[model samples]
Every structure is written in C-alpha cells, then in structure tokens.
Target: MRTLRFLLQKEFRQILRSRSLLISIILGPVIQLTLLPLAANFEVKKIAVAVVDHDHSTYSNKLIAKIYASKYFSGGTYHSSYEAANKMIEQNKADIILEIPQGFERNLVREGHEEVYVAVNAINGTKAGVGSGYLGAIVADFNQDVRLQWNQPGHFSEAPTIDVVNANWYNPFMSYFLFMVPGLIVSLLTGIGAFSASLNIVKEKEIGTIEQINVTPIKKHHFILGKLIPYWVLSMFVFTIGMLVSRFAYGIVPVGNIGLLYGFLSAYLITLLGAGLLISTYSDTQQQAVSLAFFFVLVFNMISGVFTSIDSMPDWGKALSYLSPMSHFAAVMRMVVLKGSTFHDIQPHFIAIIILGIVFNTWAVLNYRKTT
Candidate 1:
C-alpha cells in the first residue's frame, strides 16, 4: 500500500506538471461535446430541388407550393426544360429534379392516374434517398388533398385509413444529438484512458527513469496498479465533466441510474487502461507507444457502432467488434443513458468488459520485465 501510494503521488505530480497534457485533459471534452453534436446530424434537411413544370396549371403550381413548404426541402429552382434541369444537376446546383408532365392534372381528373418523373443526383446517396422520400411523401399528401377537394356529397365515404402513430421509444423527437453525444463521450474517454496509460511506462523509458524504479523492492503488480490508478481517477474526472457538458450543451441527462452508468464506465476504463499498459509494456519509447495506441484507438472507434450500426455490419465484423472494449462501452452507454437500462440489462457487456480487463492486464503484467 505504501509503495503504491508513493507511485501514485509521483504519477499525479508528473501529469499536473505537464501544461499541454493538463490543458488537453481539461479542454478536449468541452470542445468536442460542445461542437460535435452540431455537425453530427443524421436527419437530412434543406435538400436542394429543381422543378420543371411543363403543365404550369393550378394543380401543378399547388404541387410545387407543397414541395417548397416542406421543412426537408430548400426552395426549389424552376427550370423551363428537362434538359436545363439536367444541366443544373450536372453542375451540382440541384440534388433532385421533379418534372410535372403535360396533362398531369387532366390525366388525374379524367383517367384517375398520372406519372411525374423524378430524377435524382445519386452522387450523395444518403441525400438523394432522403430527398426523394420527402418528395414522394409530399406528392402523396397532395394527392390526398386533391381527392378530398374533388369529393361530392356522400361520394367518398372517408376511405379506410390506418394511421400509423410511430412512437420513437428512446428518442421521441429523434434528436441526433441524443443519439450521438453519449457515443462520443464513450469514445473520447476510451482514447484518453488508453493513450495516457499506454504512454506512461514508455515515457519513463524515454526519460531513463525506468531503471530507478526497477531496482526497488516493489512488486510488479504494485507498479502496474500505481500506473493504472492515477489515470483511472483522472479519466473519471474527465467523464464527469463530459456528462455535465452533455447536460448543459445538449440537454442530455441519463435516463437510468447514474450509479449504473458509472459502474459500467469503471469496468470499461479498466479494460482500456489495461490495453494501454500492454502497449506501454511492448513499446520502449513514447513515439512507439503513441503510434500503437493510435492504431488501436482507430480500430476501436471504427468498430464501436459510434458512426454506424453494428447490426448492419457483416457477421464476421460483428463477431470481431466484440473484441473491442469501445464496442461494449458504447452499447452500454446508449442502453443506460437513452433506454434507462438496468444492471441486469447491461450484465453481458459488464461481464465482457471485466473479462477483457483481466486478460489485458494479465498480459501486460507478464510482458513487463523488471530487469529489462
């Protein structure tokens, strides 16, 4: 205990003395939590549209008005010819071109059917898909309105309708920030914990201080724990700051027990820090530790379901994602924060993280040589 305490003191002193590290530890989360949510939007809006109205009738103008009124669409450009609209799309000035053909209103009124050609710029697939969907919805709504206006007394007896009241359980408003902030917090915390722990021993090696501690009577476990403890405490502090920023900046408060979230985070950090120590044990210099840590962090972020859904990944990729500590942490965070998941709900992830911590820390211990 006494030896561990002294080592912890030394590590904290070193961390506090480094101005750059201190600033990063304090400012990095604030900046990311504040700025990332604004740009991480998944809901496509303000899609640029081009319209070619050949009919130019009252119905056609009403349809164009409906498209312009939608929040999803930007004010559309009116082109005289389909060729002109194609040119606009080629120039990247428009994402979609809606062409209302001649006799569109006449066919709808007289023949009960008409076709409107829609051409989309598929270069940005997500934008194209979302914009097209929004346009289709508007046209459907306009068709319904036309039917209601044309209905005579007792002619259309309120066509049977099945209203789908879509209930978004976790995020009712579908706020992108609600979905993204927690994942970002988990990812950033993982990187900070892993990078700091990985760099600790290697930094000592670079500065020629490892020889001094190695000659002491301290056990290997004590040295490892001492290295782990300070960063663990610092990471918890950073996590708290991140949570506060999430609350104030994005109105995100964990729907579950705060204690449960902290419990999962504790285990997740242990696994990440152990990986860092493993990197430190293998690396002889700070540069080598950084490169290795960056590599692991990048892989973890890519597979962790932060930017994309794990369910959408291939079977092999899903199986491989379980190997990443960030994957477990990201899942647990979303479950607890958004869904109000309990300990029982997150038991599998908790157990997985604990096993990872044990495996990684054991490997790091075996790799650490007092004499080397």
Candidate 2:
C-alpha cells in the first residue's frame, strides 16, 4: 500500500507537469462534445436540383413551384432540354434532374396519367437517394392535389389508402445530437483513458527513468495499479464534464439513473485502461505506444456502433462487435441514458466489460517484465 501510494503520487505529478497532456485532458472533451454533435449530423438537406420543363404548362409550373418551396431542396435550375440539364449535372451544379415531357399536363387531364423522368447524380449515393426521395414525395403530393382538384368522384373511389403515424421513441423529435452526444462521450473517454495509460510506461522508457524503478523491490502489479488508478480518476472527471456539456449545450438529460451510467463507466474504464497498459507493455517507446493505441482505438470506435447501429450490420460484424469494450459501453450508454434501462437491463454488457478488464489487465501484468 505504501509503495502504491508513492507511485500514484509520482504518476499524478508527472501528468500535471506536462502542459500538452494537461490541456488535452481538460479541453479535448469540451471541444469535441461542443462541436462534434453539431457537425456530425445525418439529416440530408439543401439538395440542388435541375428541372427540364418541356411541358411549360400551369400544372408543371405548379409542380416546380412546390419543389422550390420545400426546405429540403436548394433553388433549382431551369433548362430547355435534357442535354442542358445533363450539363448542369456534369458541372456538379445539381444532384437531381426532373424532366417533364411535352404532353405532361395534357396527358394527365385527358388520360389521367403522365410519365416524368428523374435523373440523379450517383457520385454521392446517400445524397442522391435522399434527394430523389424528397422529390418523389413532392410529386406524389402534387398528384394527390391534382386528383382532388379534378374530383372525378367515381374514378378513384375504390382505391385503398393507408395512413402512417410515426412515433419516434426515446427521441421524440429525432434530434441527431441527442443520439450522437452520448456515443461521443463514450468514445472520447475511451481515447483519453487508453492513450494516457498506454503512454505512461513508454514515456519512462524514452526518458531512461524506467531502469531506475525496475531495479527497486516494487512488484509489477503495484506499479501497474499505480499507473492505472490516476488515469482512471482523470477519465471519470472528463466523463462528468462531457455529461455537463451534453446537458447545457444540447438540452440532453438522461432519462435513466445518472449513478447507473457512472457505475458502468467505472467498469468500462477498467477494460479501456487495461488495454492501454497491455499496449504499453508491448511497446518500448512513446511513438510506438501511440501508434498502437491509435490503431486499436480507431478500430474499437468504428466497430462500436458509435455512428451506425450494430443491429444493422451483417452476422459477422454483429458477432465481432461483442469483442470491443467500446461496443458494450456504447450500448449501455444509450440503454441507460435514452431508454432509462435498469441494472438488469445492462447486466450482460456490464459482465462483458468486467471480463474484458480482467483478461486485458491480466495479460498486461503477465507480460510486463521487471528486468527488461
């Protein structure tokens, strides 16, 4: 206990003395939590469109007007021919082109149907799909309006209609930031814990101080605990700050018990910091430790359901996500924060993280050599 206390003191002092480390610990979470949710939005908006209006009739003009008034579309370009509209697409000026044929309105009135051509730029597939979907919705609404205006009562009376009422649970407004901020907090904490812990032993190696401590009577577990504890405390501090940012900036308040969230965080940090120490044990220099830590953290974050849902992934990917501590952490975070999940609800994830902590820390301790 006495040896561990002194070692902890040394670790804290070392961390406090480094200006870059101090600034990163204090400011990185603030900046990331403040800005990332605002920037990393999934809602597609302001799609550029081009119109080739060969009909040039009242109904066609009205259809174009409806699209122009929509918030999803940027003001469109009008072209006389398909060639001209195609040129606009080639110049990267438009995402979609809507072509109305010559007899569009005439055919709709006489034959009660007309065909319209839509061309979308596939360069950005997501933008193209979403933009075209918005355009199709506008055209559908226009058709319904035309049918009502015509009021050919017996013509369409037998058609079936189904109305859908969408209710978004946990997030009623579907605020992307609400969903993203919790995951971002988990990701940031993981990076801070892993990077800081991984660099501790390697930094000593780079500065020739490690040889001095290695010669002492200190046990490997004591040294490892001393290194891990301080950063674990610091990571919790950062987590608190991130939660506060989520509350004030984005108006997010966890629907579940805040204490439960913290409880899981404590366990989750063990796994993360243990992984860092494992990396540190393998790396001989700060540069090597950082490279290895970055690689693992990036892979963990990518597979952790941070930006996308794991349920949507393939069988192999879903199976692999269980191996990532970040994956369990992210799931527990959303379950507790958004869904108000109880301890029983998160038991599986909690057990998974604890097991990971034990496995990783045991590996790190076993690999750490006092002589080398």
Candidate 3:
C-alpha cells in the first residue's frame, strides 16, 4: 500500500511536469468538442447549380425562382447553352446543371408532361445524389403547384395522401451537433486514455526509471494500478470538462442519471487505462508506444459506431466491433444522452466493459517483467 501510494505520487508529478502532455490535456477536449461537432456535419447544403433556360416562359421563370429560393441550393447561374452550363460543372463551380428545353412550358401545357435534362457532376457521389434529390423534390412540388393553379376549383378532388407524423423521439430538430457531441466525448476520452497512459511506462523505460522500479520489491499489479489510477482520475476531469462544453456550447444535457453515466465512465476509464498500459508494456520506446497506441485508437474509433451505424454494417463488421471497448462506450453514451436509458438498459455494455477491463489489465500485468 505504501509503495503504491509513493508510485502514484511519482506518476502524478511526472504527468504534471511534462509540458507536452499538459498542453494536450488542457487543449485537446476543448478544441475537439467545440470545433469538431460543427465541422463534421452530415447534412448537405448549398448545392451549386447552373441553369439553361430556353423557353423563357412564366412556368420556367417560376421553376427557376423556386429552385433558387430553396435553402438546399445556391442561386443558379444562367448559361446560354447546355455546353456552356456544363463547363461550370467541369470547373467545379456547379454541382448540378438544369437545362430547360425549348417549348418546355408549351409541351407540358399541351401534352400534360415534359422532360427536362439534368446533368449532375458525379465526382462527389453523395453531394450529387443529395443535390439531385433536392432538385427533383423541388420540381415535383412546382408541378403540383402548376396543376393546382389550373384545376378550376377542385375538379378532380384531392388524391389520397398518407402523412407521416414525425416523432423525432430524442433530437427533434435533428441538430448534427447534438448527435455528434456524445460520440466526440467518447473519442476524446479514448485518446486521453490510449495516448497518455501508453506513453507513461515507455517514457520511464527510455529514461532508465523502469529499470530502478523493476529491481524494487514492487508487485506488478501495484505498478499497474499506480500507473492506471492517476490517469483514470485525470481523464475523468477531462470528461467533466467535455460534458460542460457539451452543455453550454452545444446545449446537450444528459437525459439519464448523471451519476449512472459517471459510474459507467469510471469503469470505462479503467478499461481504457488497461488497454494503454498493455500497449506500454509491449513497447520499448516512446515512439513505438505512440505508433501502436494510435493504430489501436484509430481502429477502435473507426469501429466505435459513432460515424456509422453498427446495425447497418456487414455481419463480420458488426461481430468484430464487439471486441472494441469504444464501440460499447459510444453506444452507451448516446443512449444515456439521447434516450435517457437506465442502468438496466446499459447493463450488457457495462458487463462487456468489465470483462475487457479484466482481460487488458491481466494481459498487461503478465506481459510486464521486473527484469528487462
């Protein structure tokens, strides 16, 4: 117990004295939490469009105006020909081109339908798909409006319509910030645990401190616990700061019990610390530790179900993600934040983390030796 306490003191002093680690601990959460959510947005907007209008009719003008008025699209730049308009797409100035053929209004009025060619730059497939879909919806609405104007006091009566009552459950406005903040919190904690803890032992090894410790009467588990505890506590501090940032800056408040969330975090931090320390045990140099830590952290974050839905992934991907502590952490964080899920709801994740914590800590203890 005395030995562990002295070791804890040494670890804390070492962490505080390092300028680089201090800067990372201070700045990492704030910048990532504040900036990343705003930037890593999924909702596509401001689609640049080029227009070629040959008809110059009332309907054509109205359609052009309607497309421009939409929040999804940038105002269209009119070109003399389709060839001229397509050049905008080639130059990356336009994402989609809308060409109104000659006699577009005449054909629609006389034949009850007309086709207009739309050429979208498929270089950015998602932008193309979403931008084209927005244009199609706007055009469909315009057609409906034109038909209604010429209907002469409800001649055909209203067609059967099914309206979906949207129960948005958690995020009513679908703010991307709200969706991203929780996941970002998990990612921030993961980085702190992985990079910071992984560097600890390796740095000591490089500086010849590990040799002195190894020759001491210290137990391996005591050495591991002393290493893990300080960082775990510091990570909790960072997590608290992140949560505060989420509240004030992004307006995210945990719908579930905050204590329950903290309890889960406490256990989760142990698991992450164990993982980092395990990496530290295998690595001889700080460089090797960092590279290994980053590789694992990247893999864990990618499979963490933050950016992609686990259910939507392939069978193999979904199966493999279960091995990552981060996958469960991100899921549980979202559940607590959005769904107000209870302890019972998160029990399975809690158990998974506990199991991982045991495995990682045990491996780290076994791998680390008193002698080189």
Q: Sorted on TM-score, highest at the top, how do the candidates line up?
A: 1, 2, 3
Q: Please, what is the whole-model Cα lDDT of each candidate in the order they appear? A: 0.91, 0.92, 0.90
Q: Per-residue lDDT tens digits of candidate 1, residues 1-372?
A: 998889989988989999998778879888988998788778888888899999989899999988998888895799999999999999999999999999988998988778899999999999998899999989999988887877764986877778677899999998889999999998889888988899999988889888888888889999999999888889999999999999988899999999998888888888899999999999988899999999999989999999899999999889889989999999999999999999999999999999999999999988999984
Candidate 1's error at 309, in angstroms?
Answer: 0.3
In model 2, the runs with Cα more than 4 Å from the true position are 152-156
Best by lDDT: 2
What does candidate 3's lDDT look like per residue over 57-139, in tens digits?
Answer: 98899999999899999857999899999889889999999999999999988887998889999998889999999999899
Instruction: Give model 1's TM-score versus the native structure.
Output: 0.97
State candidate 3's TM-score.
Answer: 0.96
TM-scores for all predictions: 0.97, 0.96, 0.96
The per-prediction CA RMSD against the true structure, in angstroms, equals: 1.4, 1.5, 1.6
Off by over 4 Å in 1: 156-161
Residue 102 of model 1, lDDT score: 97
